[model samples]
Target: MMQRLRILTSHAAVNLMAAACFSALAALAVWGPGWVWAFVPLGVGAQMLNEYNLHRFVFHLLPPRAQWAFDLLYRAHYGHHDFPTNEKLFFVPVWVAVPMLLFNFGALWAILAALGVADAVWIAVAIVPVGGVLAFLGYEWFHMTSHLPVRKTRVERYVTTLHNQHHFRDFTKWFHVSPGGAVIDRAMGTAIDRETLKTRQRSEFIRTLGLRPDDPRLVSARRRFATRYGLTEGEIARAAAH
Candidate 1:
């Protein structure tokens, strides 16, 4: 458990979000106490929807034809699917997480203020920096645990099972990693019925996001990020052999 947490906190994105959540909660406690009860739940619910939509729509979008664009998506998500146990790829990258957090908070604040909410800024704080970020941290924790080789609690095991289905069975299903976010997946029609698909067939090209292991794009991406991501020659070769 300690090791898993160490790995979780190692990512810059995790640390930043952790700080944001704490800072926002502290600020809300001092200045916007009344708004906390209402807005925090709103933030959490909003982030749950955001988590499902981003995973289903954005991260799982068709591979880009452009090598550069493909590389970006590979770093953002494809590489995680290709190497499911790679700790480095477990959390959302800081470049992606930080910007999206800013955009969401800014947009919410603007919308509320324009609509004449007197406490728009603090309300956004309560919702985003506090509640939304807390849910994001939950996602990071569960996601990291899903990939780690550790004994898990009952709830953790359940989450890991569903997440494994997404990684190994069908990438298109089970987009929500955070607990309780599965309802969003069910509502959005992405949740697979385990009873209906008893055989649990693995998705084609499961490791490469439906691309051939040796496709030019995968080859280029692996080579391009090899040194940066510490992918040894053997790992690169093995990925291509899949």
Candidate 2:
């Protein structure tokens, strides 16, 4: 667990969110009302919902035909699928994660302020920087662990099973990576049933999101990011050859 956390906190986005969470907690300790803490679970629930929606809708969107557009999605998610074990691909990129944090917190604050909630800033703080960011951290922890070769607790093992199904079995299903967030997947109709698992074969192009291994876009993406991500020539060739 310590090792996984070290890997997790190594990312800029995680560190930023951790700092924000700690600052929010410290500020809350000084001036936040007791009732504000009650909304922490709501923030957590919001993030869980955000986790599912973003994975299913944004990250898993149809691969754009334009190379530049495809590259954005590739960095945002497809590269992770293409090289599931790459530690650098395990966390959300800082660009995506930081903007998302701003948007979620800002949107919640705007809504609360518009609604005339007297404690809009503090309430938004309670829910977002405190609760939502914590859940996002949990999502990152489980996600990174799921992709690594490590002995896991019962819960981590369970999460890995579901996440592996999404990666190795079917990209369209089991979108939730955080523990206990399977409820969202099931509710959203993205969770796979045992019967389907029994009947279906492993997905074609599982690593490439239904794109052929040598699809020009993927080939170009690999080359484009080879130096950036330290993908070896051998790894690039291997990825292209089925």
Candidate 3:
């Protein structure tokens, strides 16, 4: 179908662009000033931070009502939440991600050039998106495998089940697809406790409160609610609390 071909072409273009960016960065790092390499980590960190913020603030909070905005957001985010295992929807559609990535990298490069760090900026502008693409690819593949009909290996099975648990039970904690694990989520106080997560699977009582799962305020709220209702500490400590 034309739709499938379009999707394939879009995915391919995004990936190719990412690869070209990486190659450019690599070439700059090898031939340019040694100091340029120092900016690599910062570039990676910026992209990661962007990913975190976009997921937290944009995708989760800013629901779209307008037709174009809704379709864009739906493809980039909402569709994933609606059907987490939909292989066709795993990677961010190229139409959405490519232009934004270029604009961001271009802007950052311009700023760095103004600061007399053009070489470093070039490297970063090249490498960061490439690294991001690799991360995106990993997320896409893992997400697809997670929902596949075929049985997974033990570790794969664990991660897939964990991701599914995040979709059906707790959406806050387990935000990272894989490899990244809970590093940023834990730092942001959005991580679900393992034991508490287990408890959430058995009880639907906690899901009634439409609390923002990533918000830290829910922690105190849970404690207060428990005290007010005379609920057991274990019950109050459920992952659904935050």
Candidate 4:
């Protein structure tokens, strides 16, 4: 397991290049002949929102009714949830990444071209890709770091805790892998904290029974424990409603 903690694998490097290059372009966009840094935030914000949308709509989305869609989405995300520690699973294979890279670049370029801003097309092109790839690289790095056995930085500890919260405490919340992506989650109203409920009393019961949250055997645990603790079904319903 300690050996698996290594970073800078070929897979990570390949996935990282898009962002590394775009970040340089972003710096140039800021300090270059055009001085179009304002668009950087637009790019960043767009990427942030895009990350949130992907997490919520795709990763967290229920596998569709259609078999093919279900298999596709399940392979994309559900397996990650089931096997969170598999470093081998973390890599986006070159085969998949190449097509996605082309599509993302072409799509953003086409979108910017359609907007028809006089001097802004090139700026938009640079900004858009920089924003997205930057966010993605940050996400992959953050996520991988969160799974690392040794966490050191203040930011790492914070984001890793949130990532743990997403995996174990509550899967539906903390969907964003980037720590500050919580801002987008909050703005969009999906930020939830079950920590209070999990830690204060209910979690005590869960611990006492030694039941994992995902344990099928614990299917009635929350309801029964809530009842014993005098919480009404309505309260649980309301909590879930959020």
Kindly indicate the candidate among 1 and 4 with the higher lDDT: 1
TM-score of each: 0.96, 0.97, 0.65, 0.67
The sequence of per-residue lDDT tens digits that candidate 3 reaches over residues 24-77 is 567776776765556555655555666667667776655444545554555566
Per-residue lDDT tens digits of candidate 2, residues 10-60? 898899988999999999989999899999999999999999999999999
- Candidate ordering by lDDT (highest first): 2, 1, 4, 3
- Where's the lowest-lDDT run of ten residues in candidate 4? 204-213
Global lDDT scores for all candidate models: 0.87, 0.91, 0.58, 0.58
As for candidate 3, its clashing pairs are none
By summed lDDT, the worst window of 10 consecutive residues in model 2 runs over 197-206
Clashing pairs in 4: none
The candidate that achieves the highest TM-score relative to the unseen native structure: 2
Total clashes in model 2, counting residue pairs 3 or more apart in sequence or in different chains: 0
The lowest-lDDT stretch of 10 consecutive residues in candidate 3 is 202-211
In model 1, which runs have C-alpha deviations exceeding 4 angstroms?
Answer: 199-205
Ranking by TM-score: 2, 1, 4, 3
Candidate 1 residue lDDT tens string, 53-123: 88888899899999999999999998898788888889899998999899999999999999998888998
- How many clashes in each structure? 0, 0, 0, 0
Cα lDDT, model 3, residue 129? 65
Worst 10 residues of 1 by lDDT: 196-205
